[model samples]
Target: MPDIVSFNKGHYYLLGLGVCVGVFGLIATLEHWFSIILSEATVKKLFRVAVLGLMLGLLLPHFSHFGFSRYFQSHGYISCDAASHRWLHSVILVYTKNEMLCKELIEARK
Candidate 1:
């Protein structure tokens, strides 16, 4: 087994990614199930964004702290802990924007 070391970036990175993905997935799933008030087009867009966001979240751990920092360095985000914020916030926007889309879809079928 690998040794446990303090201040291991890999450990912290995994933790951050996990939290972001969990939040994104939970909110998206909740919206899909409980918000039966979206349109098909909007639903599709949300689902698409969710899938892409999920993929990004899953791959986040593979990147180094420096990589993430540099990649998002120009997006007006400061500090080394911005990746987690970016991921979660991006997903949340997608979910919120498409919330009505899912509702419309369910409403149309009724």
Candidate 2:
């Protein structure tokens, strides 16, 4: 199987890019709507506040892991340590076995 760690890293990279684009769009929309009455400095300050709020909104839940960790586990979230161990085990197995047999073993494990 493809490395799950790399797969999830790629997924998060794309997700972060999407969030950047969305935040930029939000700021632009806010400036357009409020530019008539708001000063440029005020708009800039508003943008700062908006970005701060967005960051806090995204991160606050992680601060309290009481229910969140259980929710994540029940939803098939694998911890980083577990993922690294699994990947290392697979690499060792593949390296120690015959190439053709390793391929078959990997496929069968899937």
Candidate 3:
């Protein structure tokens, strides 16, 4: 097993991604059930609730110390940690320019 002490930002990001994916899957399952068991209007409302919950779940990590640092780094809110900041910039910068760069960055990080 990999040492917990050896885990880095990339590992945490992967874990966060896994959690987001799991929440997405769960929301989708609930949506499916709502469609089958609820009236159309109720299904729509519940589906919206599910989607909102999923979005909040995905954003939860961004409120953490590690995630907040990375997010601020990506946005240029802080500059004390250049190395880590650059890594996060690589992840978020592509959103303003080329989406492919994010994929390349993640691949390179791996």
Over 1-110, each residue of candidate 2 has an lDDT whose tens digit, in order, gives 33231222223333444565666666677658766555778767766766665565445434433354454445554433322223321321112112454445456656
**TM-scores for every candidate against the unseen true structure:** 0.32, 0.31, 0.29
State each model's C-alpha RMSD to the native. 21.6, 9.9, 11.4
Give the range where candidate 3 is weakest over 10 consecutive residues by summed lDDT: 1-10
Ranking 1 against 3 by lDDT, winner: 1
Question: How far does residue 101 in candidate 3 sit from its true spot (Å)?
Answer: 38
Over 80-104, each residue of candidate 3 has an lDDT whose tens digit, in order, gives 2212233551333222123344445
Residue 16 in candidate 1 has what lDDT? 56
Worst 10 residues of 1 by lDDT: 88-97
Clashing residue pairs for model 2: none
Error of 2 at 4 (Å): 8.7
Question: Residue 8 error for model 2, in Å?
Answer: 3.5
* Overall lDDT per candidate, in order of appearance: 0.45, 0.44, 0.45
Among the numbered candidates, top lDDT falls to 1
Residue 28 displacement (Å), model 3: 8.9
lDDT of 1 by residue, 1-110 (tens): 11111122344445555665765666667677787566668767666666665566556545645564554444433332211223433421111113344355345546
Candidate order, lDDT descending: 1, 3, 2
Measured by TM-score, the strongest candidate is 1
